[model samples]
Target chain A: MKTEEMITRLAEGLRPVRRMPSPPVMLALWTLLAASVIGLAALVFGTREGLDRPMTRFDMMHSLAALLTALLAGLAAFELALPDRDRRWAWLPLPAIGLWLGTMGVGCVGELVRLGAEGIRFHVSWPCLQFIIGLGLPMAGLMLWLTRHAAWIRPGPVAGFGALSAAAFASIGLTLVHPTFGPLMVLAWHGVAVLAVTGLAALFGPRLAWRVPA
Target chain B: MSHAQPLCLMLAPGQVARDARDLRWSTLMAAAQEGDGAAYATLLAECLPFLRAICRARLRDAAEAEDAVQDALLTLHRVRHTYDPARPFRPWVAAIAERRALDRLRRRGRQVARETLLDDAAELGAEGEAEERLAACQLREAVGELPQAQRTALQLTKIEQLSLQEASARSGMSIGALKVATHRALHSLRRRLTGGAP
Candidate 1:
């Protein structure tokens, strides 16, 4: 009859959806989104005619973008399934982002070799490199920033490594392919990350040491 | 003005109440097991008003009362596994509301205060306090539709509060006959009351 009583009735389902989140998860997703958008841009360049000469370079960049989108959205969805306290384990994504970004240097060297041998004397041209930097290093930096919340976190080997593996793979395959992902696919991918990150919170977030027990 | 006024019931009126009356708690429990949100919502809606009143009377303030209700409902779902189907549902619910209210006060580390001594038993008025303002009109209107014996038996048992033996003795009927009359009276009353809408 009263408003509070009404709220309590409605709250049964809403209780589990409280927006508790993890640190590593935030980094992982941020890295993924930043990289995905950049990857999408490179995809635009590859599709456009002006950037036709160094095609493989753009293709590889495109592939990395798709991968980041998949990984970030997946992380988001997966983490969301975890319990409330465990939601913050999302911070684990930060270090994983770092580990992932570190791998990009390796991929870029190979691309740099491919570009140099072609005798193409292009100026340090903007969109191409900026796109690559956006996907590759900036994502890593964003992930690292996300993980800065780690001081309050309890050590969790499984989540930490899982997030790291996700980020590392996101970074390792940075220059791997130039596949085209539709916007819907990108959204679904983003959905999955949001779901994972939030799901992980729903499932395991409650156990995170930083979560004040309800 | 009379038609526009809210029903002043513990539950939502008309279709919602009818829907709830049609509800079978057993069905809800089954649907909830399969993760049905709608069924769960219905179940929660049905019990909430009574649970709210109990909580409000038992606890110190509005916030604490609602919080205790939430905790109790969670516990209800948690322990739904243990609810025995054969027993009446109310006492079990009342026991849970009582326990959760007590638990909430204890958690707050405050002494449980009471405006009235018997918290759960508080009433809008003492029993029969409003009897004069409304009485025989309702009973006669509803009971008029019953068979003569059934109507007489019901009046003796309910309004007169006579025991079955006393009712039978007073009415010059066998005990078995009196029981049958009461059952038929209730069936007739239910049909008349509920059938009017449909």
Candidate 2:
């Protein structure tokens, strides 16, 4: 069909639809959902046995960093979903991601320095990975569904950040339930799950979600 | 990959054109959002040339380019509510166009692959049947090009492989007339194939 004819048909069929909420509003909604999921997971799984341990500066820093990372990543994902919006918005989460990595690095180094080679023992928990992924699945699916109408210019970055946002929020829940393991172990397993989710989303998100008219 | 650069540095003269177009579209879109049909029609009408240009640039085939433009327009209509007046309109439109073009390309690729597989499968079957199939196609074309009476007679008797009496009954023609029509069609086909006058 001719372009003019198609355009005419489209205009004739136009029906007013409510505009999507702004990125900030969507991010807020996502955050609320993430918090609810984390809260529910914590309640169901139970908090770690050391509920009474005095919160350390490191612990506070880590929690803050995780929260910031999730919030920033969520915001970036929402912004990236819009096509004509500035691509620079993709960088919004960088600082928070850096802080997250820095906190993990500092925690691992501090652990290594205090506990010499003999005191530090490396361990991997299969259930930790399972819990993180299991909780992350719904959050990831929700993020994808929310952004389905978005015209993704850089689908890879958008999907990567989206996966990161979901995984980070799920990690928060995992931390509350799982017993304290070595900092390095936490970093390794959590980091692996984050990377895996991000990699998978980047690879297949465009094919699955970024469909246009045939 | 090059180090990430600011989107401002990446802006080109084309973006300036986009800015102007987007400004106009945003106004029209805002009006359309408020139930202004004329404004909406004008917006879509104005978008046609731009959509055509983008589709042509992205797609090599002219027909495919036109189809992609239509697809993009339909998609734009479906997602019109997603448009934010604050954002530039061209990139939003371009993103949809590029996506549609890419989808067409991907689908075309898959279709070609499937056809290739089917051709290979056909080749693996009775090799002698290939020549027979080609001859059958040519004969069908030749018979179709004949006059109506001759075509009907040839189709009934030759292609359908029916007996003269059955073909006569089906076509409401006498056996002698059907025979004469079929004979004339074959003679005409032979002359055409042999590069002789009918």
Q: Write one digit per residue (lDDT tens) for candidate 1, span B127-167.
A: 55346324545546778877888887888787666567546
Candidate 1 CAPRI-style tier: incorrect
Give the C-alpha lDDT of model 2. Answer: 0.76
Deviation from native of the Cα of residue A141 in model 1, angstroms: 20
Against the true structure, whose TM-score is highest?
Answer: 2
Candidate 2 chain A: 10-residue stretch with minimal lDDT: A205-214
A121-161 per-residue lDDT for model 1 (tens digits): 32332332333333433333333333322212222333333
lDDT of each: 0.48, 0.76
Stretches > 4 Å off in candidate 1: A1-44, A47-73, A81-85, A88-95, A104-214, B1-38, B41-198
* DockQ score of each predicted structure, in the order shown: 0.02, 0.24
Where does model 2 exceed 4 Å of error? A151-155, A204-214, B1-22, B34-38, B98-198
Give the distance in Å from residue B32's predicted Cα in candidate 2 to where it truly belongs: 3.5
